[model samples]
Target: MNIGVIKETKTDETRVALQPFQVKVLIANGHKIYVENNAGVLAGFPDDEYVVNGAEIKDKKYILDKCKLILKIKAPLDNEYNDYTKDHIIFTYLHFDENILPDKIRELIKSGFMGIAYEWVEESGRYPLLEPMSKLTGYLFAQKAVEFCTKYKGIICGKHEDYLKGANVLIIGLGTIGLSSLKFCMDNNLKISVLDKNLATVNIRINERFKTNKIDYIEKYSIELISFNNSDPLKTKAELEKTINKYDIILNCAVRRPDMPKDKLEYLIDRQMIQTMEPYSVICDTTACDNDLIETCVSSEEVDKIDIINDVVHYSCDHLPSIVGKSATELLTSQTFPFILEIANKGISEAVKSNKALYRGVVCYKNKITHRYIAEKKGFQFYKLSDLV
Candidate 1:
């Protein structure tokens, strides 16, 4: 098996798909590893390190032409589209749900490569590959929230007793990203409240995680839990209007379903709701898109670029993990290496047939769209991998 690690071409994307250590392991397992020249440089793993670890350091063109399997941090850019063939297997964060454009999706299908999206690969109802980066993104978002509030709002976020007045933070959703943000807010002694669709379940999880015997700090802390119903936007909006103005910061980590109808989608926080927020208050949307949970959030800004809407600071950088390249690459590659090794050893056909998680990750295989959600969302014909194989 011949595998190639390509340099990420996305703007501000610094993470590499495979680390030097992983390259060494793959080579030891009777697999040939070819890393693009300087592929891991931005992530602190130099080409020399890969060469030392038994990986051939070659240019992108040479590696793409030679290797059948391609490992990447991001999907192939427009310029690299022509280089792919039906024989290639691209394993990366394809982001067909949102980040990727229609033309790119079309190109991917036309190219007939087996496209395995890292974010879609799941095990035990968890996205194993996506979780690490999600956690990292949440941690970075919390740090950015603090920085944005202090810089733009001119106030420190801390406990009221130690400071003049504490900042109130409202975290939307209770997923990995939201919980990570909540932990950071709790450590900073900010008045924290949580909003989720199922408040009771969230309460149970929170209580279980912060048991009195385990954690003393959160034992006495009483967090207000708010319920949100996405189906009833008007009701949710009315309920939020009552207290939306009180929070100094709002972190939206809730994800919108990719197959959701555009007409049916409603903003969780509209312009009017944002208007109620105090001047200079910050809203950070971790799950950022064009029509995100936060109406003002657009994924166009570069890392750390703040947008001001109605005097409220909005921080929504889609690739927050990319900013912390070294940590992200190390965490991401560790999880993805095992899957890569499986494919390398067993071949794509055998690997996908044997591993359900790997099969679920395949969005496009055998010149057809294999993922139902992606197929429906993109209006493409969907085919089962079993049928295709």
Candidate 2:
């Protein structure tokens, strides 16, 4: 079976779909790989590298239409691609941002080529190939969030010649992204405060990996408890109020809530309780895309409100894990390449027979929607790819 690598035409996208070293892995497995010219330039892979690795630099046509599998980091632009048939498999990061599905994603699904989203693999929690990038986004957000909080709040965290020191960072979840952020924060010697609804589950799954707070946000930091999934926001006008100065940066890596619960927002902004800080106190809510989260954050209502006091979000932030381009590509590549190589060697049939990486549409073979959020968007029926298998 032929595997194709296409140019990543997305504007300002520095990472390539396939790096030179990765192509050689496929070739070593006796698979044919066709790459578009200069596909890996930005990632530091020269044209000579691909040639040495035995991948053919070919025109887009044979690589797209003829190959049984297509690998890319971006969604295929509809106008540039050939017909998408049921037999084809396109593996990519299918970003879902808004209520309105982007034309690129709608077209990919309409193209009807068995679409496998690395991002959605986590939605099922069975095969989590995409966690590394999720980890990447979370880690970077934590580091940058500290800067946003200090600068906004008017607190000086580090010296000109030194790295950030003794920052107070709050990580809301314990997933890979959350864990990565926590680790990054600790490595920088920042004070960390962890909050979560479920102590049991978080401890069981994340504690061992994170070393059970061995990283220590406590000696120099403060901790708080809150529930998000099962209970309504606590009307703790006072308990939460006490938590005010205890924290400097709140880095939310949890699920998005476009607008947060009204009570939650009220707790955040009560002037006498919080506005007393040096003024750069900030909340870098990655969950801002969620209507529940955005609608709830008082910061969005008045970016100046915090800026006036000194807390500000210094850099533009997003769920676009791609911004940490080279790191994202390398981590995502190392984590996902093994499965692609398996599929290449055995073909989809034997490849997926026992392998969890195989997914058809949104459904797992178990007959469940791997991504309920995406299904909710377009009213598309989800079948379990596992059951079908």
Candidate 3:
């Protein structure tokens, strides 16, 4: 099997799918690995490292044309569509439901090349590939808040009592990213509040926290929970606006996929709601998707200027982990290498047919949508891979 790694062309993306160490592993398993020139450069892995690890450094054109399995950190950009063919098996974070994705990618998905999203691959009700990245993303949200707070207010973000004595943090959603953010605050003794749509989840997570050593010393008043659900967007928006003005830093961990209807999509912190936040407050969006929960969100590429929407700083970088490229690339490679191996060794059809986790990752195959979410959202005829296989 010939496996290829390509340099990510997405704006501000720095992580690479295959690390040099992983390249060596695949090569040792009798698979030929072709990496695009400088594919791992930005992620702190040089061309020499890959060459030393037995990877052939090839050009983008050759890899796309000849490789059987294509690995990428992001989905194919608009310009790369023509480079792909029906024979290619692309594995990456194909956020297909992202409203801002190029139209051609949608067309390509329906064209029958197998597309596997690392985030969508599930086993035993857990997203194995997405978990590591999600935890890192959540932890980094706290670091971003610190960076932006120092930039805007001349106040350094730190855990020491005197450094950021009055900084208040609000985290929306109690998922992986949200809990990680809470962990940061607890470790630093920062004043933090959490909001979740699931009240039962909030109760369970909070009760479990009492048994942990992380939040024991923090003042009970400093750490608070604001409970609400997705039953009513308008009500949630109103609720957010009411307390938004109190926080100095906001980390939105809410996740919204493309298949959701306009009304059903959770926009807890819309533009109107954001206007109520205090001036100079930062909103760090971990799930940086199009038409985000934070309506005024911008991608990392477009975040150069101070986007003062209603005087609040809107910072939404889709690939936050990429900013810390080395750690992210290593973690991503660790999680995804096994799946890549399965596809490389068994072939796409056989792997998906035998492995339920890999099958869950398949969004398209055989000129049809295999994933129910994408098929139903796009109003296309859905075909279960089990039936087709």
Candidate 4:
């Protein structure tokens, strides 16, 4: 098996799909590993390190032309589209549902390469490959919340005895990202409240954590659980309005599928709700999609530049993990290397057929759309992998 690690071409994307250590492991397993020159440089892994670890350093053209299995931190850019062949198996974060261009999607279909999306690779209903990055994003969101509050509003985000009250934070989801943000907020002595589409699941997680004596902060501070109707955005907005103004920071980690209808995709926090909030309040959307849960979050912004709508600061960076390339790449490779090894050893056809997680990750296989969600959203014909395999 020949595996190629391509340098990420996305702007501000510094993480590499494989580190030097992983490359060494792959080579030891009797697989040929080709790394693009400076592929891992931004992630603190140099070309010399890869060379020392038995990886052949090659240019992008050589890698794409010779390697059948391609690994990347991001999807192939427009310039790289023409380089792909039907035999190529690209494993990366191919976010087809999110603001991807129609032409790019069509190009992928036309190329007939198998696209195994890292974010969709699931085990026991959890996204193992995506979890590390999500946790990193949560930490970044919390840090940004503190910075925005202090810089824009001239108020400390954390609680202090001298102050009458600490900053109030509303976490809009209780998934991996939300829980991580909650842990950080608790450590910082911020008043925290949480809400999720499934309150029952949220209660179970809280109760389980409390029983294990893991979350002592929950005992010290009353963590309120707010509920809202996910089906009706207007009603949810109305419910939030009663107390939305009181919150100093709002971290929206909730997810909205791209295939959802426009009517069902109304903003959880509309402009009218933003007008009710205090000046300089921070709203960080961890999901980071345009016209997502936060109405004011028109588009993803750079970490340094934030959008100000109705005096509230909106922080939404789509690739927060990229900013912390070293840690993010290390954590990402730990989970992804195993899957890559599986595909390398067993081959794509055998690997996808044998590994359900890998099969689920396949958005495109055998020149057809294997993922129903993406196919339906893009108005393309859907083909099941089982039928094609």
Better of 3 and 4 by lDDT: 4
Clashes of each: 0, 46, 1, 0
Candidate 4: residue 12 Cα off by (Å): 1.4
Q: How do the residues 311-347 of candidate 2 rate in per-residue lDDT, one tens digit apiece? A: 4332324434556567767877786787688778888
Cα lDDT of model 4 by residue, 50-110, tens digit: 9999999999999988999999988777777788888899999998977786667888658
Residue-by-residue lDDT tens digits, candidate 1, 141-238: 98899888988888888785754687889999888898788778887878888888887566465555445333433345567878777677567768
Q: What lDDT is reached at residue 263 by model 2? A: 50
Q: What is each predicted model's overall lDDT from 0 to 1?
A: 0.84, 0.59, 0.78, 0.84
Q: Rank the candidates by TM-score, best first.
A: 1, 4, 3, 2
lDDT score for residue 178 of model 3: 82
Cα-based RMSD of the predictions, in order?
2.3, 5.9, 3.0, 2.3
**What TM-score quantifies how close candidate 2 is to the native fold?**
0.73
* Local accuracy of candidate 3 as per-residue lDDT tens digits, 1-389: 99999998887678999988888888888999999999989889999999999999999999988898999988776677667778888999877656544355466665568888898899999898988888888888787786777788666555576544657888888788887887777666667887776754564565464455443333554567677655566676677788888888888887764543467755667787777777788887778765567777765643233466787877776777877888999998898999998888888889998999999998877677788876665566778887766
TM-score list, all predictions: 0.93, 0.73, 0.89, 0.92
List candidate 3 segments past 4 Å from native.
156-159, 162-164, 199-221, 256-266, 301-306, 387-389
lDDT ranking, best first:
1, 4, 3, 2
Model 4 worst lDDT window (10 residues): 209-218
Model 3 vs. true fold: TM: 0.89
